[model samples]
Target chain A: MNNSIMILIFIISTVAGYKLIKDVPSLLHTPLMSGMNAFSGITVVGAILTTASAAALHSKILGAIAIILAMINVVGGFYITDRMLGKFKSGLKDK
Target chain B: MELNIVNIVSLVIILICAADIKLMSSPKTALVGNRIGALSMLAAILFVLIYNDIITIPLLLVSLIIGAFIGILFTYKTGGVKIPQLVALFNGFGGGASLIVSFILLLEQGSNIDTFARFTAFSGAIVGGLTFSGSLIAAGKLEGIINQKPVTIKAHSMITSLLLIILLAIMIFGTVIDDYIVTFASGATVLSLLFGVIFAIRIGGADMPITISLLNSCSGLAASVCGFAVGDIILISLGAIVGASGLILTQIMCKAMNRSLWHILTGSTYRKVIDSSTETIVEIKSDGAKKEVHNYLEIVNKAKNIIIVPGYGMALSQAQEQVKLLFDYLIGKGKDVRFAIHPVAGRMPGHMNVLLAEVDIPYEYLCDIDTINPEFASTDVVIVVGACDVINPEAITAQGTPIYGMPILRVHEAKHVIVCNKDTKPGYSGVENSLYNKSNVTLLLGNAADTLAELISQLQNDLQSDTVLQD
Candidate 1:
């Protein structure tokens, strides 16, 4: 029953998410993605919270992996963001 | 679980955004984006609950109010700047978010990381990182911080191909070598970063809208990878939908400029811009056109249909409000005033729309280039405000010019043309206008803003004088 419920949630979330962004005008996608990036950071917190709360050995191990990947995601994402932002500064290469 | 306050807060924001979208008004500030984003997520969650048979009707109503307040706060704080910059800034966040989500999912999977999970995680991280960075560059360019030149070199072709191959090899071989994987992946990431920057530098500012759209597509793909990594069907589906659309836009932009996408990025195709050094030519045609231009004031009062064409000069003049003032006055007097918007007129996409919207002009008054071009044939007067290149007639006549075969505003089609150029100069394509020589076209040489203001103020006085004389 739980597995079925999970599956139903997954299917609905997929459809709902698709409905929201599927028709987003190409012009508006950048702002949409940028906003979502900030919000996506919440997932890292979610992983950490799961690690703290879960009692099962496998769950704990999964939580640890989630934490590490989350850290990498945040770090790599920010690094690239900063690098790209640097291009906009004056005295960079012409064009 | 029952629907709670957090869910409610999210729903209201989405409703507002939906309303805004239905009205076709883009959001201005990061805050509006935050609210709208919050709302979209809320709506998605609600849909999730309904699909799972989790929500009661009462819970949904309360959530809407909470979401609405948050949405209002978000929109209120950002001062609502709706432009390409806002879009780029938002996309950077989305790409970065997906990358993070995938990372968390990897950790959640722990030792149970299957082959599918590993593939998705790596793909998401790499693409997401690239999107996050690429978006920032685009934002910087739009924000007036980046170098706006095409960074071209002789060996760019060979270098790009080789680096891409190396990156692919690292992804395939490094996994077996386990310990070497991180190093290889990091190297690939670095190469990708340089590729993005160099690739961007090769495309000129005029092509930035296309670049922005392309980077957006990459971001979507990154999110899709994250979706697969986490088994999040929502992420995968939404990402794919947007990714396909972005790619189509890139294809269209490339075709418009008569260049393949790769040729545009490598800077190999347009070798002509480099061979030429442009110089200003000041030819004084002291003919009686200057005096004749001033005569336009006499007809201003009686003119029934007045069409205004705005350009970069008008943008530089920052006289959009004053232009609106002229229009408002005309409209008040029961005269028809319409805008002739050239597709590629301003520095960026929909630039004039943002400026005009800020001044509260009805969107209906603005007409596309093709729509307005035909109107000029029957129109009495076309008041061109501080524009240079897109309105030029030379593109149609001079096959030798780089802008040959490019369609432009048919300002020459009008019975009487009033052109306001800063000086005798070419536009973005570095070609002089052929319309200047036409007898019907009067060159009102001055700064666009001041000239337009003068015309409006002068017309008011003439109308007043005529009224008093009749009384």
Candidate 2:
């Protein structure tokens, strides 16, 4: 079982997935994004891993840099997202 | 053939991920469901690190759990980010992480130039860079911190097109630009990021969902590419899953607006006043229109069945209580009362419902278009309060109109239609309502609550006088 072959399969599927998504209609976006927001949150973990893994690795410099960027993505992502959702909350005054 | 506990654990984690797809339908539970799924995934990854004896790090697990708790707290605090902005931020985060991963692998692989690893490294970095910037723009728009109106850049399409061409040329012909190839890539990343901001801002509020979805797809593409760069199969598969789903949602949104994805993304949409004439409809003067209001009450009092259709204007004018008052008055005298609600009525979804709910209107009396539309024929008088677009007869009667196919309450289907609105002018799209011109429609010119309240007062006075005459 070559890891390279497995990686190629994953890449090919992702490209195909992109093509599949490109073909869908635009109306379902809000619902779809809402649904994916949960799953795509894997990035939250990716954020911790970026710095955590990098710091432990021999190249402390790269790991430290990765930590900073990952923190930005995590903190910024959560902050901005909450603000955006807030706009739709309560109710539209119908104006 | 030896299977380790890490392999067994990974299989369990994959199963958990597969089962988590069911949470998509009812997103109220998505946060909790995803956290559990994410935790399962983190644990599996942790197991991989430990089983291989790669390293023993307890802080990562603690931080991961803490991060999951913070995410849950966010859901409670802001009530979870709305779907579009949430997606945008998620895409950005995903892309940012993928970018970092690609960069790390590059440091390792750059030592051996011309290797497959280098190709993956570059691919991941570029895709992640694009996704990161694009997501930021999308997030900014949805968050309302940025203007919802599209930013009209000078020479917009031409600039983006030229940039893409130059980037393609640079990527293809490497020899001519030898000294600073990496620099060119870096420059392109900046340009893409800048363009991403401009591209997102170019889309107005009505179209934010589509842009966010497209960006979601981009982030997924970035992740898959990074998976390639770092040789990770699981990441690529999951990226494909997300990218496909996001694009499907994007396309659905385009169709709902009766548009193509390309036109929506590329074309500039604005609130244009299409050739409208206030003159052609025999514009009754305000006084003449006021006279018609008296006759309308007579018809309403005499009607056997009545359905009231309320909309945004009614809510804006705080007329829900007034309508509720009218409902009680009518029902007290033994007249039928019901309400028609459109699915996408007002400025947002279910807006009318929320307003009516506030007024303590029974849910049973309130019916969505599917159930209440056909019942309009049986209704004798349909009093539409501050509801223009939703009750517009043009939606059902005129095929040439922009709202032609769009579903609307069939208030006009009643024997008599009473339209109460502030402005004689058409609604947001400026489409002349056929209901306004119909002989059966008696236009009421005043604030919704004021008009309805006054009408009720007039009816009460007349009833008392008639009783006196009978005595």
Candidate 3:
């Protein structure tokens, strides 16, 4: 794909996301923020690519660190958000 | 064929994003939605690894296992009360990861990288650096490791502008000069990191939620640039979704506080020392006219319908358990009871809801400002538990107040009000709550847990005696 076309797609997708998320009640803002945090961990792709392509010792080390950090963001963010959402019981049963 | 597969994966990821957004709107399915979002992210990661044939199996497995183990441990061990700080730290990690990825990308490309790729890498580096450092400071403030007050450096705006200009000049010169590109990139990274700290530290505790959301957006923006640099469609789409959602969250937070983004950034919305001093005088005058009820138990027992407003103070005191006991007792007594939650209550967005939810407060019993505000008028008693600003009548009554025009719980509309707080000190915004001085208001001065415990014991004794008399 051309770089400009990719940029255009990025802008359109972002605007669409903005519209979709605009009406989220304040009750769920924390979850939304944390969910997005997990989503941002898509950088793990770049980290993996960098690690695989690394030719130098420095690049390898950096790649390793990036992968770990991004994974942590992804895993921790989702788990914590789930813990939070789990607490929002419908007043029916003790979970 | 490879391009077609990537395109299909990107479309699937976008569909996942849409599903997550829709699921997040409702409480019951939100958890499933969160899980689905996580699974999709995992699929994207696997797709990238497999399609690119970047199969350094040992290295990838080791790093992922270590990271996942630590993440699981951290998330599981940390109590719900510390969630805000945890979220902040996770955001910092995301930012740091993006920064590291961009740095490595830049190094690998060297001078042979295309201008577009170079520009994207530079942006990714700068934004990621800012998000990483800024989120750390935000976590510190929330944890009380750093001062919660806004730290004003004289001429901060001018200094920030100057630093930005210098960074731009370096980037431009580095691109043009080629030979000094590495040096310039390193310099820009350092400057960006400094800018993040400076920008974040000046925001008051009251505005921390908005700041966190903004930093989250920056991290997402950084990841999007990283995607562009690497030519990954899934990363780009996921990054854009997070970036856009985070930006909207920031706007929502600003709206909740009744302030513009610019006002928050320039640090003008924070109440200054002079303004606080003037506020003290107004508080004294209001205090003189107010009648403080000493017989809190008597008033509470007499009230038929009651509402409890929880805020940051409640979280600080860890009073949610006692609050639950009180609610149960009130319900047993046949009183109509409900909890009113402010949008920007506590240190982060949805902080109060999470706190109450942790204590098993039913979702139906918890009400937002709009739903609960009208009920306040018909309510016999209103308990302001460790909350000051959200219940402040000044938001509507007093013009020119720092918190003016902000939507509040309208607790003053109740026939009687009981304020349970540690002291008469103003709230996070440093603005005095005039609601404290109303004639119907009673100040219950003590820690929220202790005060609530006393109330619970008193109620329990009364119930026991009544049962004994009937027997």
Winning candidate number (TM-score): 3
Candidate 2 interface RMSD value? 7.2
lDDT of each: 0.56, 0.58, 0.83
Candidate 2 wrong stretches, greater than 4 Å: A1-32, A44-95, B1-11, B26-74, B79-87, B107-127, B167-185, B271-471
Q: Could you give the DockQ of candidate 1? A: 0.07
lDDT (tens digit, per residue) of candidate 3 on B1-471: 245878888788878867887799888889999999988888888887788886656787688788888889889999998998899998988888888887887777747777777777777888888898899999999888998888878899888888778867766665566676777778878998898888888877778888988888988888898888888877777789889988988887888889899997777756574455645544335456766666667678778999999988899899999899888888878898899999888877778888998998888888988888889889999888899888877789778877889988989889999888887777766677777777888877799999988878976776667678979
C-alpha lDDT of residue B94 in model 2:
66
Candidate number that wins on TM-score, 1 or 3:
3
User: What is the TM-score (0 to 1) of candidate 2?
Assistant: 0.65
Every candidate's DockQ is: 0.07, 0.19, 0.73
* Candidate 3 per-residue C-alpha lDDT over A5-41 given as tens digits, one digit per residue, 9 for 90 to 100: 7788789879888888887777778888888888888
Model 2 per-residue lDDT tens digits across residues B1-471: 136553455446655654554442332433444455555655655564566454455555444445545544544454222434544665676676666666655444344444455555566666677678777776777677787656767887777677666645544442243355456445545655665665666776555545666777767666666655554445556666666666665655454344567765564553444334444543645444333445666677778788988766785687888998998898787887888875444332334654565465654566767788889988899888877666776876677666666667778778888777876667644577667766677877789889888889977777776678979
* Per-residue lDDT of model 1, residues B1-471, tens digit only: 235543344334334533422322233333344444444544554554455353553333333344334333333343323345545655555555555444444444433555555566666656766666677777777667887655566687777677667756765564344454445545645665666665665656666656766776676677666656655444454455446545655664554444467766555534354235245474646566533445666666777887888876776667787888888888888787788776445544445644565576665676766677778877877778876556777767888776777667777787777777787666656666767766667777787777778777888999888889999
Count of backbone clashes for each model? 32, 17, 0
C-alpha lDDT of residue B229 in model 3: 81
Q: Highest DockQ: give the candidate number.
A: 3
